[model samples]
Target: MRSRSLVVPAVLAGLLAGSVADPASAHEQVSTPSAAVVGAAPASRVTAGWTLVARYGFDGGRPTPIADESGKGHTLRLVTRNGGTVSAVRHGIGHALRFPGKCLTGRRCPHAALQSPSAPNLNPGTRPISYGAKVLLSPSQTSKGQNVVQKGYSATSSQYKLQVDGAAGRASCVLVGARPGIKLITSTVSVADGTWHTVECRRTARALTVLVDGAVRGNRAIQPGLSVANDRPLSIGGKGAYSDNDQFQGTLDDVWVRVG
Candidate 1:
């Protein structure tokens, strides 16, 4: 209802030119570890083998109540400060949520973020996990480093976080826990050039890997003795545990998480 009057920009159209994808066909998993990446979600194609745990298909033209289409009701709330606005526009997949970069940009910067209630799947204990999202960032938008999606928000915090450092044009996926040390892998590939790209993180039993557009960009070996279970809610478009400090300045679509 709030999105009926929104106008899509021409440049955003260019950035989102692609065949629209249908929703993923995965149901509740069988619980025996069937795949390597996850389910058959259009967004999780590359990070194969894991099962679908949650999916925030923000295809809804509005930001609040981001629906989880994984058949599990892990719905996310569109949190805001002072009732700021978070807009949506046509993305390649359908509609994508946008966030403001900083404090004084007229858009919903740190004031608005998407959050889901804390769930067990989000706190994957000593298990492999994979998650991904389709994202876009304009050249002029300026947020030094923003998190695309995360379970933990701060330095030395929870399960994991996927970040896009706009200033560096790089992405990093990190898993933090005391049991096995931290697994940090970064991608040298740039994703801030106003184009649509898929960014993903895969944490297996023996290694952690970060991928950009289906290619492995960063990887590191680690033990499988970590427990990321915490009370923090899963968040997108901002750091969940950090009070939305690193609000993402761009658009996000087709977010999925699979806990192996």
Candidate 2:
């Protein structure tokens, strides 16, 4: 059985691993948490059967620990680069993180993201997995591609990512097997119309599917044995606080991950 003492220490470890020691060199910092913690994230029927690994509502605003709603202790820490910033703002009646859009040409672009430490449970291995976020983006913010969330890098290892691609603001799901090359399927409908939209990506033994607003928008076949596993953190908003990191410029709420 899990004890409070054990849980407390594990949570502390997660905090330390996420904290930014030096913003100048590291370009990020975890904010000091508040005394009162928010309640667990609202349950999702979409994750009814699968095990929820992590969930963030961004409820407490900036500088507070981005609590993992799943209660699995995979809290997220904020990261920023250049002049980037992330703020906790009210979205409809709930809370969300607002990120700055891309900067003009030749200008230093600020970048921001949320990340969790590499943990065994976060790696789905050969199991099916699903991840998604409630996003609000504008057509003007669209670019070649702006990553919403991802784990692993295809150039180095297997990866699973959801990104909005092209000026059309089309959302797409991507997966890279242990082998070379990328496997992607894009949504037929664009979600970059300045309205709140729920976008999700699911990877099964047979295929990869992207869903928008609870409706299937794209699907692609895949090898039944294709697998995804890596020692990389789960990233949101962008890959990291680095230059040209496929930064997402918009608001994000209820970001979550489930594996089975």
Candidate 3:
């Protein structure tokens, strides 16, 4: 069993491995978590057989310790840069984190993301995996590709990403196997129309399927199926502070990931 993390607070000092601490923009101080407590995250009223890895409702307006509702101890850490601010607001069941989508200087939209302190056992190999989130995009998104949630962007890196195709295209879930075997499952309709939509992606042995708004929009077959790579930390909101990466310009809530 994984050593459960405690819900204390957010600390930005040594969050990233090798990132320099900038003094240019006075970013928001990370929330202070209580401490590293034992045991899994608080058990939910209902538990599923699929085994919930981590669920971030963002109910608390504060950042750190997004509170692993799954009682799995996989607490999420906040990573904000360049005047990025994350405020907790009401959305789905309780609250959601609102990503300003614009830079504090009102110039370049930096980025805000949530990362698990340690990589959970999300590498389901050939086993069944499911991820779902409720999203609401801002009226106008400046970037073309804004990532919503991603594990590993590349194939050799061994990961998967759930991101929007372009600024205005449908959301796509991608799973990369070894070279020559990749699955880019996308939604039929666009979900970036400034509305709340539930998007889910399921990865099975033979195929990768995406269901947007409870309808099957994309179902793609996996070539050389069952390849799990990378123990990289899972990221939400954007891949990294990059232009090509899709930095989700909206509010995200009810992010749930399960593996069997």
Top lDDT prediction, candidate number: 2
- Deviating ranges (above 4 Å) for candidate 2: 1-47
Runs with alpha carbons beyond 4 Å of true place in candidate 3? 1-48, 61-63, 102-108, 118-120, 241-245
Per-residue error for 12 in candidate 3, Å, reads: 3.2
- lDDT, candidate 3, 1-260, per-residue tens: 12222232333535544322222132111222222222323222221578788777766533475667787877777665554556666554466667656433433655556776435466666677788788887546534455667676462366676776654556777776676544576566788787888887777667677777766666666754567656666778765433223457778888888886
Better of 1 and 3 by lDDT: 1
Cα misplacement distance, residue 59 of candidate 2 (Å): 1.3
lDDT of each: 0.64, 0.73, 0.61
- Looking at model 3, report the run of 10 residues with the lowest lDDT sum: 23-32
Query: Could you tell me every candidate's TM-score relative to the true structure?
Result: 0.74, 0.81, 0.76
**lDDT tens per residue, model 2, 1-92:** 11111111112233333433211232111221221211233223554699999887766533445668798988777666665767666775
* Candidate 1, residue 121: how far the Cα is off, in Å: 2.0
- lDDT of candidate 3 at residue 217, scale 0 to 100: 69
Candidate 3 Cα lDDT to native: 0.61
